[model samples]
Target: MLNEEKILAILRLQKCKAVGDILAKKLIVHVGDVVQIFREKTSHLSKINGIGKHVLKHLFTKENITLAQQELRYIQDNAISYSYFLEDKYPQNLQHCVDSPILLFEDGAIDFSNKKIISIVGTRNMSSYGRDFCTKLITDLAPHNPIIVSGFAYGVDICAHKVAVQNNLQTIAVLAHGFEQIYPKVHKKYMQQVNENGGFLTEFWHNEMPLRENFLKRNRIVAGISNATIIIESAEKGGSLVTADIANSYDKDVFAVPGRTTDLYSKGCNNLIKNNSAFLLNSAKEIVNMLNWDLKATPKIIQKQLFLDLNENEQKIHDFLHDKGKQILDVISLECNIPMYKLASILLQMELKGVSKPLPGKMFELI
Candidate 1:
C-alpha cells in the first residue's frame, strides 16, 4: 500500500497536463520514486528522456497540487479504492500495455486471480443477433469461470455484464467516467448486480465526466485486461473495433463472430477476419481452443493431422515461426526474404490452413 504522501504525489502527477502514463512512468523511474519527482529540481528532472520545460511548467503547478489534495480528501472520506501501476494488485495484463493508466479506481470485489479474463465488446446499438451471441457466448463459457469485461455502456457492453451476472460469472465494467456519475443513467439500475458479480473500474477521477475521448481511452483497458477480446458484433466502424485493434496491438488474441455478407454490423467483424486481424469465431469452443483453456469435466477434443503440407514460402515462414516462436510480420518477412505485400497473403493462408495464428502486434506463431 502507498502512504499518504506518495499517493498525493501520484495524484498530482496524474493531474499534470504534460504527463501521460508513459511519461509518468519514465519520470518515476528517472526520479527513483513518485515523491522524488515532485521534490527534485526542475533542472535535473529535465535531463531525463521525454522530460522538458513544457512538461515541467505544468508538473509543479500549484493548481495541480491543490486539485490533487482535494481529490485525496474525497478518496479518504469516501473510502474510494485505487491501485497504483507499481502495486502487485494492478491488472497483470494491463501492466503489459505501454500506455495503461498510472492509477486505477475500483469498486466492489474485483479479483484477477482467476486469470481467465475475456473482454466482449461491440456496438452500443446492439442488434438482436449481437445480443443473442453475447448471451450464449458468456453462458457457454460460464463453466470455465472466466471473468467477463465490458465498457458498461448500452448494447453489447451492458448485455455482456448482465449475462455474466446471470451466469454467476464475474463481470467487470470498465467505466469511461468517474464513479461520481454513471453514463446513460439507465445502467445505474444494474450497478448493484454488477457489483455483486464483479465490479467497476476506471482511471478517471471522482468527478470526471464521460467525455468522448475517455471511451476511446477506456478501450485499451478492456482490451489489455483480457487474455483475448471477443467482438460479438460490430458495425462498419465502432468502438468495439477499436478495442479489437488495441487488443491486437497488445499481442492478445481477438475473435470476431461472423454474420451475413449484407448485414451492416457484421461488416466490421467480416473485415477483421478477412484481413486476418481476428479469428473467425463460431462458438465458445474456438475461444477455448485458441486460448488453450481446460474444462473441469469435459473430454478434450483433439484433431490429429497425419500429413501436413506446405509450399516453399509457407514452409519457410512456418519453419521460422516454429523455431523462433512468435514473430512480427516484418521480421518474418525479413528473415524469410518474402515481400511484405505477398507475405500478408501467405500468413493469411497459413492462418486458414491451421498452420499458424495471428496475434496482436502483427505477430504470428505456429499452431
Candidate 2:
C-alpha cells in the first residue's frame, strides 16, 4: 500500500480527462512525485512537454479531487489492492508498454514472478474446434506452468480460464469494467474459482460500467501483460485481432491456429497467418520452442526433421541470416530486397517452420 495522500493523488490524475496514461506518466515524472503533482502550480506544469492548459484545466479541478477522495475511501473500506506502474510489483511486461495503465486495481492471488505468461483471446462465438484446441493447449502446457491471461468474457476467453484452472495453472482475467460488478452476468459463477486460482484485474474505477470502449481499451492490458498472445479463433474483424496487433507493436510473439478457408470464425486468424502478423500455431510445442520455455521434467527427444521446406523468400532470408549471423529486421528486409511489411510475414513463416528465431531489437537468426 500506498499512503492515503499518494493514492488520492494517483486517482485524481487518473480522473483527469486530458491526461492519458502516457501524459499522466509525463506529469508525474515532471513533478517528481505523485502527491507533488497536485501541489505544483498549473503554470509550471504547463511548461512540460504535452502538458497544455487543457490538461491542467482537468488536472486541478475540484470535481476530480472529490471523485478521487470518494474512490480512495472505497479502496480503503473494501481493502482493494492495486499496483502502481512504477512499482516493482507491477506486471513487468506491461510496464514496457508506453500506454499501459498508470495504476491497476487487482483482486485475488496474482503473482507475476512466474514469467511464463501467455494471453489467449478469440471471438465470443467460439466453435467446438476452438474449444478443443484451447483445452488441449492448456493441458499440454500444464507441465511448463504458464500463467493464462485473457479478457474473461465469453467463448474462448472463459474457456481458456476454465482450462487453466482445471490444469492447476494460474489464470488472470483482465476486465473492462470495475470491481463493483461482473460483466455478462453469467461469468459471475466462475469468479470464485478464478479468485482462488489467479484473480481479476482492471483499470476501471468501482462504479464504471462495461461500455463498448472499455473492452477495446482493456485489450492493451491483455496484450501487453504477457510474452505472447494466441488467437484461438476469430472472424475477419474482432477484438482478438486488435490484441494481436498490439502484441506485435510491443514486439511480442503472436500465434493463430489455422482453420479451413470456409470456416467463418477462422477468417481473422487465417488472415493473420497469411499476412504474417502471427505464427501458425499447431501445438503447445511451437509456443514452448518459440518462447524457449524450459520444462522441469526431461524434455521429449523428438528428432528434428532433416529439412524444412522454405519458400523462395524464406530461403533468401534464411540464407542471409545463416551467412551474416543475427541481423536486424530492417537490414534483412533491405538486403533481401523484400519490403518491410511483406518481410514481417515472411519472417513469421520462417519462424513457424523452426528455421528462424526472433531476437530482441528486431534481430533474427537461423535456428
Candidate 3:
C-alpha cells in the first residue's frame, strides 16, 4: 500500500495540467522525494530543465491540491491497491518505459511473479480463422505458463483472455477507464473470473470514463507490460497496430501471424513483417524460442565491480547488497529504509554503472 502523503503528492502531480508522467518523474527525481516536491519552493523548482512558468502556475494550485486530496481519500477509504512506477511492485518490464504512468490503480490479484507475460491483440471484428488461430496459439503457449495480457475487449482481446483463463494461466486486462465501470458493458460478466485468475490494471482514477483517447493511451500499457506483443489479425488500420508499433519502438519482440495475400484482416500484419517491424511468426515454438522460455531460469553471476561512485540512495543499496549476498527487492528496500519505488530505479542505475547484478524474480546483489 502507498502511504497517504506520497499518494497525495503523486495525485497532485497527476492533476497538474502542465505535468505528465515524464515531467512528474523529473520533478520527483529533482526534488529527491515525492512528498518533497510539494514542499519545494517555486523558485528552486523553476531551475529544473523542464520546469517552466506554465508548470509552476498549475502545480500546487489550490484546485489541484483539493482534487488530489479527494482522490487520495477515495484510495484510502476503498483500500485500493496500486503500483508506483519506481516501486518493485510495478511491472518490471514497464519500469523501463520513460513515459509509463507514475501510478496505476489495480484491481484483484495480478501477479508479475511469472515473468513470462505476452500481449495478444488484434481486430475487434474477428474472423473464424483468426479465432481458431488465437485459441491454438494461447493453448500451445500455456505450458510455458505465460501471463496473457489484452484490452478485455470484444473479439481477439476477449478470446486471448478467455483461453488463458481456461488454461488456468494468469492474465491481465489493461483498462481504459477507472474501476467504477466496465467498457463495452458485456465484458463485465467476465470481471469476477478475470479477478479470480489475474486482474485489471489502469492509470485512470476512479469514475473516469472510457473516452476514445483513453483507449489509445491504454495501448501503451498493453504494449509495455509484456515481454512481447502479438497481433492475431488486423485490417489496414487499427489500435493493435499502434500497440505493435509501440512495442517495436521499445525494442521488444513483436510477432505477427501471417495470412493470405488477399485476406482483408491480414494487411496490417503483413505490412508490419514486410516493413521489418515485426517477425513473421510461424508457431508457438518460435515464440518460446525467441523469448528463451525453453531455457532454465537462474540468476546471473558477475565478479565484484570496482572503483564506482554511487549517490546517497545508490550507496545505501550497495551497502545492503554488499552485506547480503543475494537479496530480493522487498528485503533490500526494507533494510535500507528506501521506498521500493525509488529503490527500483536506483538499483537499475547501479546495474548500468556495473555496481550491481539483478537476478530473475527481483533479486539483486553486488557484482
Error of 3 at 41 (Å): 1.1
RMSD versus native structure for model 2:
11.5
lDDT of model 3 at position 150: 99
Clashes of each: 2, 1, 4
* Residue-by-residue lDDT tens digits, candidate 2, 1-367: 7888888899999989898997787666556678999888878887788888787788889999899999998998999999998667889788767788999999999999899999999999999999999999999999999999999999999999999999999999999999997988999999999999999999999999999999999999999999999999999999999999999988899999999999999999999999999999999999999998964558766455567798899888877876666765645655676765588889888888888898765678877
Cα TM-score per model: 0.81, 0.81, 0.85
Measured with C-alpha atoms, the lDDT of residue 310 in candidate 3 is 85
Tens-digit lDDT string for candidate 3 (247-334)? 9877789999999989999998899999998899878999999999999979976566667788998988887777646665655665
Which candidate leads in TM-score? 3
Candidate 1 stretches greater than 4 Å from native: 295-367
What local lDDT does model 1 show for residue 206?
A: 93
Note the residue pairs that clash in candidate 1.
Answer: 248-360, 248-361
Q: Which candidate's lDDT is highest?
A: 2
| Cα lDDT, model 3, residue 30 | 60
Q: Score residue 366 of candidate 2 by CA lDDT.
A: 77
